[model samples]
Target: MARENKRKAAEKAEEGDEFTGREDKRPRKEKVQPSQIKNKEKRSAVYAKLKHEKQVEKRKKIKARDAAFKQAIELGEEPAQKMVPRTIENTREADETVIRPNDEEFLAGNDADEFSTVLKQQTVPKVLITTCRYNSSRGPAFIKELLSAIPNAHYYKRGTYELKKIVEYANNMEFTSVIVVHTNRREPDALLIIGLPDGPTAHFRLSNLVLRKDIKNHGNPTSHKPELVLNNFTTRLGNRIGRMIQSLFPQDPNFRGRRVVTFHNQRDFIFFRHHRYIFEVKEKKGDPKDKKSKALKEKTPKKVIARLQECGPRFTLKLVSLQHGTFDSKGGEFEWVHKADMDTSRRRFFI
Candidate 1:
């Protein structure tokens, strides 16, 4: 019995060894990369082949989706929902500062904010636009376009006057906001937006400025107040900034003018675009069976397609700092300031 047990144990050990040996002898597959090829021609060929394979796979997926959709239609069933591609904006890190639609506290706070009076239409928004002490020719041109864009906006030349003095003057003149365009090396590089009377000032780094004349086939702006569109201003700070900007324009827009001023924020950068839109009637030919049907069709409004023409002076703004009360560099309280450490993560965003 002892000898039989030993023999069985030995057999089991041999089987284990055999399994290990089998695993060891198995050929492992390694991923073949196009970069591994030393020959440039071969590398190019491999890259092309890989691209072709990807295209073929994509086509196959599309075909399969089409086939499934057709089958669902035939069976009078719901088609599969298309998958939404993940993007940086969609996958951003969750922020507590992001404002919710039903936040009573935020809503209440906003009602009594500095720009609240203007936003509520209690008072008209009067904006005073100015440049740095040392100005450039292009600065005036940009200010001219801004004048056309914003209603009740007036430009004042900055003739060696201090910003504090200008802010005081704006407050006295009952201006709701003050825009100070700062230029560096003859190029407009920064913008200072100061909310009048009380406080809350925002400093933005400006870039990618394109004037009205630079735009091809740009439309002329009318005196009518253009509609204001503020997009993606979701955070608490963003909301304040949005309100400040909104205060620059009138509450009521003249839709007849078909003019629009859009401030679209993406990746914490605000893009300014002015456009004039016109609706063109789309004519459709159809034969009515009877006079009544013809009369009904005629009563129906014609399909009008909207077309947009850019009214330029397009630029981008990146928020640098937001101060609580006006422009005081040395002794001012900051609400939010952009720091180098704040940009450690690409998915993280302030506004």
Candidate 2:
């Protein structure tokens, strides 16, 4: 009986060991990173291999999609919808301030805004462009380009006068707007646009400046007022800023000049581009087998194509702040101010 008990005890111990072993399995293997590798050559080789594999996978997916599309065509069935890749712009967090098409309040506000007179053609826009008190080397060059770009814009020498005094003088002179180009370290770094009479001031951070001479094969802009194209200004603040920019130019645009000044806003950054477009006719040979082409002599077909030439001085602007009143730095009430903490998420945007 003692021997039987020992045998049963041995079986029970074995079962417990088996149960414990199942519960305490080996930990998962961690993924090895290229940065963790000590050898430079091996790290680089592994990284390249990984990149090649990813490219191959991408190509395979494209090929599969093409094959599926062709099969659908052959079978006379509806093709699968094209997949749109995910991007930050498409996946951005929803914003409540985006203006809708039939927003009556927004429309009314626009009609009664500070820029209404200029936009409505009641008053012509006379802009006064000036530099900071201590101007940089490139500031004057940028100002010269602005003078050409904006109609009836004059450059005033910023000597020892304060900005408040300048704003007062511009108001007295009937200037519709004041543009202060701030420079630092020999570069034009910021732009301050203040609407006159009644107030609303906008400050922008300027970057990626390319002058007229720097652009290759640039066309010279004419003295006629260029057409304005404002795109993607959908939010409340964006519309306000767009109106302010629109107020800098005259209401009527001379389409005959074929010059276009575009302020394209994407991801809250404004891109400024000037271009001269021309339409040209080009002859092309038609298909010989088609009945229409055969009747038209197959070689005399002409197509009109529109081409654009860059009229330079390109730059980008990001809104830093928008103040309710004019250039009173200490006492101004800001409608919106960009802060470091505001950039917590890549998918969040404000305009």
Candidate 3:
């Protein structure tokens, strides 16, 4: 300790200044002024500017692609394929059989009448809703929500039966459609819609599926079915969601004893509701005088049944439009809908 003191005294004498015990301190960080914070107007303006710039850039790229494709075609070279922001290109060659003399005469005839006749003969759809065998909690809740929207649907919990066997059962029992929910990260995030009796299957990604009980609703039973209506559902996104919902039901809506199902999207949330029509005969005001009077009294007025039950744990989907006709994370023109902004309430707004 004495040697250190002597060294310090010597160093102080050489520098001609007194030595302090404390080490040098770093400078304090400058505080941001009030002007540094961006206000609401400024933020909106900047966002609008950026959006405009992006749109301009996108148009430029599309024009360049069109020009290149045209040039290649003119030069007798095969044009490069592109699949994005558009439907898939038809790559199949024309079949010679379709153009044969026998087929040509038949093709020139009316086919719409046949399609209309078949449509008229279509029957009510019986649907089965299920989830992945491995999924329990999330899948069950999702299935329950869907069932509440479609009260007449049949449900089978996951794992009770094999997929192939279940499909066979549906075919035998004449179930019109089958809906399967898939879970990821302990949350339901996808759906599979299959038509009964060996038909096409469509896969859909269900995103941002938050339940009311998880967000605001408590342990109380939250079932109230309202007369659901889709308002201002006219955009491309709205049309796609509408089609997906429609595919869940049977082709025929005029089936006897079948309830009406409505699915409409405003903003991005798909709303569901069911309705049934009631037809009852009017009561006779006076005693029947003759056979004609009795027959007249039997006639009843037809009225739609009142739909007072309002039920839901409604959900919003994060639409991701994919390119290459695939739902994978990677591929095609993909985008997520931003519906988190509080300024616009999706539920209250129609479009």
lDDT of each structure? Answer: 0.92, 0.92, 0.54
Pairs in clash, predicted candidate 2: none
- Runs in model 1 deviating more than 4 A are 1-57, 73-78, 282-303
Stretches of candidate 2 exceeding 4 Å from the true structure:
1-77, 285-299
Per residue, candidate 3 scores C-alpha lDDT tens digits across 1-351 of 999999998777655533544543548789644345489776677777778999999999999999999999999999999874632122322323223344544444423321222224364546788887778567787787677555347898657777767778787887766777888878888776665554444455676665635544222222332232344455433433443445444454434543444564544455544444445544435545555555664573444443332234445443333122222233323332333463353233322
Superposed model 3: Cα runs more than 4 Å off: 1-33, 36-121, 212-244, 247-310, 317-351
Error of 2 at 227 (Å): 1.5
For TM-score, the strongest prediction is 1
Per-residue lDDT tens digits for candidate 2, residues 1-351, read 999999999788778879887553548799899999999999999999999999999999999999999999999999999989999989989999999999998899889889999999999999999999899989999999888889999999999999999999999999999999999999999999999986799999999999999999998999989999999998899999999999999889999999899999999999999999989998776566767645566457689999999987899999999999897789889999999999999988887
Sort the predicted structures by lDDT, highest score first. 2, 1, 3
Question: Where's the lowest-lDDT run of ten residues in candidate 3?
Answer: 110-119
TM-score of 2: 0.78
